[model samples]
Target: MIPPAFDYHAPQTLEEALSLLDEYGDDAKILSGGHSLIPMMKLRLAQPEHIVDINALTELEYIREENGVIYIGGLTREVALEESDIIHARLPLVSEVLPLIADPQVRNLATIGGNLAHGDPGNDHPAVMLALGATIVAQGPEGKRSIHINDFFEDFYMTALEPEEILTEIQIPVPPQGSGGSYKKLERKVGDYAVAGVAAQVTVDGSGACTSAGLALTNVHYIPFKVTDGEDVLVGSKLDKEAIEKAAGIASEQCDPSNDLRGSVEYKRAMVLELTRRALRDAANQARG
Candidate 1:
């Protein structure tokens, strides 16, 4: 199917893009990598009267680390993140999950901003971002402001981003010295969306007790589900098998999966339990090291 006819504007500068967004308001859709919007457009699921293409705004396609935080431009591609040594060293969970997103071709063209802004529950980055306690920066006519990951995602295919705002960057604080992160996903096959997925980040003190933990689940709810109860179970503990099991159980109980081609609700919930256990264990091991 073909997308509906629309006016196209390709802006070379961030200010121009913002101006376009301000002018068009909800009638326009920002085109970053085109992976998410193109498909929706073709399917007629989205029929914007104007398409604001920001690909030429090269300033929004960078990855930099400073002030104990990593800042990734909204237009940064998945392939770039996969190859970034800075990302691997500071945020291994991102590197580990990039390959699991889609095929190599899709990853090459997909932008992290597009993936998160699409607000798809099945997208891998949201859960990882939640687990990492990331923040999103958005710019609009008013000015730039930050939104925490916990508050950014509001519902299915929805976010806190106003129609006139554009997401500019993602910020992740550097984990503490003893921190470790891991992602575990179960898909129908390679290049498929996760049937169930879990991302875990753990920080352990010198005595091997968990100082902090973050856990999130994917493809099982309208929004990425942050498992705070599960995280609470791990903190102040040595992350022994019993603690892991209890955390996993709490995560499983929090999931609200619907029956889909990936699997039945029961099966996906079970996968969440199993994957959470494995992810927590691996993250704990890395933290202990």
Candidate 2:
């Protein structure tokens, strides 16, 4: 299928890209890695009159940790995240999830910013971000503003980013000692979108009592579902089998999924419970060590 005709601009600098966005407004689409936008355009799902390619803006490609937060550039490739020593040492949940995103070929080209900015609920990173309580940084003509992860996703294929804003960075605070995180997804094929997925991060005291917890679901709702109710159940508890079962039950009840090619609503909800329990238990075990 042929996409609608569009003017293309490859900007050498971030400022130039912003200028292009300001000029074109809603008529323009920022081309990050093109894995998401190009397919949408071919199908006529997106028909932007202008394509502002930001791939030339190399400043947006990096991964660095400072203070107590690990900052990842929006343009950083998924392969970099998968291979980064900093990511392996600092963000265990992220390390476990990156390789599961897609095959190596896709990961070599997909940008983290595009994955999130696409606002697709099936993307693995959104659920991970939700479980980690990350922050998103957006740059617009008005300069920069920070948005908490919980506030970032607004609706299906929609986000909090303004029309003229570019997502420039993702910031995640380093988890405290004795904290561990895990992500698990059920897919029919190796690179397929999750039929159901869960990400869990737990901080436990030396005595095995959970002090803090984060749980979120993927491909089970119109947006990534954060399981606050489940988190509340685990906190202050010893995270024994009984408490984990209670939290898993709450997740199964709270998630909203529809019948699809992946499975029936009932089956998806059951997988949600199963995966949530597995992720929570694995995270707790890692935290115990």
Candidate 3:
């Protein structure tokens, strides 16, 4: 269905966008790639009185590495992340997950900032970003501040971003030497949201022990959850099958999965255990090599 009529503004400057938000207040919606917002509006689930388009803000689209951090501009398209050499070299786990999300057509138009800020429980990045411990930078009437990815999602379709705030960048700290990361998800079809998804990053010590680790799961709660209990099981351990099984059990048992059209809570919980095991194993393998 066609979205209801709404005023549109193509603002070239961030200041203009901020002013527009102040002018329209809660009635204004920021438009990024339009991949998620347009569909919601089309279904009448979202009805913004004013749509502030930031497409013309060329300054916000970039991928660059500096000071041992990979800084991705908020407007950077998913296709850009897929093709980015710096991302591939410095952040392969994010790279792996990028193409796994949706399809090339959707990726070409989707932005990382929009994906995380949308606060969809099933979104790929929020879980992965939480695992990677990434930071989201934003601008607002008061100025700028950064938030951890884990803290960004508040509840169903809700986020920590204030109505006056605009997410501007994603910053990932460089992993330690010999670190490896990976993402895995189980979906009913290609390009669909995961029935259960996992992302993990592990760093091994020279003594063949886990030094640091991260684990996150998707589609099991109102927002992504960091599998801290599971990670604790892996870190400082050899990550054998027994260890992985226990870790998976911890995650599966801890997740607050609910019955949904995708699957019964029982089925999703079982899948979570299996997927988390696979993700943890793969991430450990990456770190070992």
CA lDDT of every candidate: 0.93, 0.94, 0.88
Residue-level error in angstroms, candidate 1, position 7: 0.8
In the range 34-65, model 2's lDDT, one tens digit per residue, is 88899899999999999999988879999999
| TM-score: the better of candidates 2 and 3 | 2
Better of 2 and 3 by lDDT: 2
C-alpha RMSD (angstroms) for model 2: 0.8
lDDT of 3 at 169: 93
The order by descending lDDT is 2, 1, 3
Model 1 CA lDDT for position 54: 88
Counting only residues 3 or more apart in sequence or on different chains, how many pairs clash (N, Cα, C under 3 Å) in candidate 2? 0
The candidate, 1 or 3, that scores higher on lDDT is 1
TM-score (C-alpha) between model 1 and the true structure: 0.98
Encode model 1's per-residue lDDT on 36-88: one tens digit a residue: 89889999999999999988987888899999999999999999999999999
**Candidate 2 error regions (>4 Å):** none
Which model, 1 or 3, shows the larger TM-score?
Answer: 1
Candidate 2: Cα lDDT at 41 = 95
Error of 3 at 50 (Å): 0.8
Clashing pairs in 2: none
